[model samples]
Target chain A: MSELGFLFAGYAVVWVALGGYIIAVGRRQSTLRREIARLEREFRTGE
Target chain B: MTTVSPGSTAQPDATAAVADGGAGGGVTTAAAAPLPEPGRTLWLDILGVVAILSVLVALYGAIIWAPTEAVMGHVQRIFYFHMPSAWVALGPAFTIVFICSIVYLVKKDLRYDRIAGASAELGVLFTTITLLTGPLWAKPIWGAYWTWDPRLTTTLVLWFIYVAYLMLRSSITEGHSRARLSAVFGIVGWIDVPIVFMSIRWWRTIHPTLVTGEGMNLDSSMEAVLMLSLAAITLLYVYLLIVRVRQLDMGSRLDRLRQLSHLR
Candidate 1:
């Protein structure tokens, strides 16, 4: 690969890694929110 | 007559205990309420804005503003991002993990453990970036993607150490035990850092050494660009650390709630 190609690959690696991590965290946030809501609902129903 | 007793606070003590205890729900939801989510303050807003701005400026400074090297030419540009990512990863991310791990071991506070774990996660991520970018930069320059050079090998060792730290945390089922065991690894694993830094000086290595030492002088513009990239990436690390730590804290709380519900 050319020098420019290497440069682009380096830049792309940083972004794709960062983006994937952010998405994973976001998904975890949503899952936690749902879990909290479920717990609250269960507590409320006295079941 | 008021339904609530005169001595009762807005939320009942037992209910508050349930929230605090994060487990045991025998009294049920009527006896307690979920804590209100905190409002987003101005600081986080400012941080988010700064994160976006720094990243953009860093990219521009790295790509366009920094002059191409006379010898290495266009490929030298990769050094800007590559070095900064490695700087943030080894310096702030791993150091935070090491310190917080010790604190957790001493204080036995889950918060410290959570913070340590979160930092460890980011450490692994950024190290992975460094490892990836290093090879990408090296391939065109060094003519090979992988080598057993001291810096490269030690860095790869450091990466595995933290990766193992994370995997150990994940494999455990109990909380305190997980924290206890991983804290030990976190503390011990960080000893590799100085070794990684000194490898170039300490051993015969193909990896380039001393960005501004011996004969390889850096231009002022290039140094300034490198500094800017470091500052930007460090800020990015702080921002991500805050976010990940908060997420871990909430995750532990959810775990407690699940346990309590299970008991019911």
Candidate 2:
């Protein structure tokens, strides 16, 4: 690959890694929030 | 430490509780599972915006404003993001893990453990970036994608050490036990960071040393862009660390609540 190609690939790697991590974190957070809310509602109903 | 036990008295003002499964069943005290503050959410939102904007500015500064190097040409631009990722990984991210691990051991507090774990995850992420970017830069300049140079080898080892630290954390099930064991691992795993930093200085290597007892090698413009990139990446790391730690803390609380509520 040319030097410019390497540079583009390098930047792409950084962005994809960072973006993928953020998305994974957001997904996990959403799932956890849903579960917590559901359990909370369940407890309230039992009360 | 938010241990769940049967027959304990439930607080009347508990955030969640079941009434009929025995008086105290399915009740967890607020103190045992404290939630993140509402104001902190707003603070995180503002921080997220600032971090994103700073990163964009740094990206522009690196690609456009920074002068091209006479020797390495345009590819040298990779160093702006590449070095900063290494710095954040070795400098702040792993260092935070080392400090938090020590604090967790001393205080036996799970909060510090969660922070340590979160920092370790980010440390691994940034290190992975450094490892990947370094090789991409190396392929064109060094004529090969990798070498057995001390700096590169030590960095690879450092990456594995923290990766193993994370794997160790995930392998265990019990909370305090996992924290205790991983805290020890995190502390010992930190021994590699200094070695990675000093590898180039201590041994003959092809990797360029940007900083020395004298000063950095870059011209003023390159230095400015590098510094901006460093600040941008560091801010991004901090923002991610806060958000990840908050989520991990909430996950821990949810686990305790699940145990209290007898949820599957």
Candidate 3:
């Protein structure tokens, strides 16, 4: 790859890694919240 | 009514425990209430905002404010991000794992283990960034994507060590046992960090050593940009650490609730 190509690729990797991590964490947070809610509902209804 | 401080080890009162008080009723009791979700505080909001802004500023300084190197040209620009990512991974991320692991061993508090686990995850993440970016920068300059050079090899080893640390944490079922075992692994794994830092100096390698006994070899403007990037990345790591620790704490509470519900 050319120098410019290499430069862009490096920056791209950084952005993608950081962005993907943030999104993953956000999704996990949502899943955990949903699970907690479901469990709470189950407890409340005596199911 | 209990509020969770983001990284605090304080156990939240479980509704399942309350429900279990009736012994055989399961959830038939009227006293059982939903556990409060870990809510975001105003400080976390400010931290999120500041981390984003600082990263933006660091980006601008890296791409525009800094001068292009006569030798490496635009590709040298990658150093700003590359060095910072490496620093964060090796410096704060793994170091926190080391410290928190020791604390967990001493105090036997699972909160410290959670922090250690969260930091190790981020450490792997940033190390991945470093490994990927290093090869990209190397391909155009070193003419090879990878080599068996000491610095690179030690860094790769460092990454695998922490990856193993995380995997060890996941393999165990019980909390205290997992914390105890992983704490030992974490402490031992940290021995590799300093080796990675010193690999270039200790051995023959193509990897460039930017710092010396005197100082970093970067030009003044380049140095400024690098510093800004370091600060930005550190802030980002801190913000993420707090957020992840909070999530882990909540997950712990949920696990306890599930266990109690099972006993009913």
Best by lDDT: 3
Full candidate order by TM-score, most accurate first: 2, 3, 1
Clashes of 3: 0
Residue-by-residue lDDT tens digits, candidate 3, B1-264: 254333333233554444444345444534656565555788998998999999999999999999987666898888899889989998889999999999999999999999999999999999999999988987876577887666677779899999999999999967888999999999998976676657644675454643221333578998899999999999999999999999999888887665555444
Query: Model 2: per-residue lDDT, tens digit, A1-47?
Result: 88999999999999999999999999998888766655655575555
Worst 10 residues of 2 chain B by lDDT: B207-216
Candidate 3 is scored at a TM of 0.81
Clashing pairs in 2: none
Please give the lDDT score at residue B241 for candidate 3.
93
Each model's lDDT = 0.77, 0.81, 0.82
Q: Which segments of candidate 3 are over 4 A away from where they belong?
A: B1-37, B195-217, B262-264
Q: Mind giving the per-residue lDDT tens digits that candidate 3 earns over A1-47?
A: 67898899999999999999999999999988876665665566555
Place model 2 in a CAPRI quality band. acceptable
Write one digit per residue (lDDT tens) for candidate 2, span B1-264. Answer: 356563353355443433333344344433245556322567789999999999999999999999888777888899999999989998889999999999988999999999999999999999999999988988887687887666667779899999999999999977788999998988877975676657644675554643221333589998999999999999999999999998988887776676576533
Model 1 has an lDDT value of: 0.77
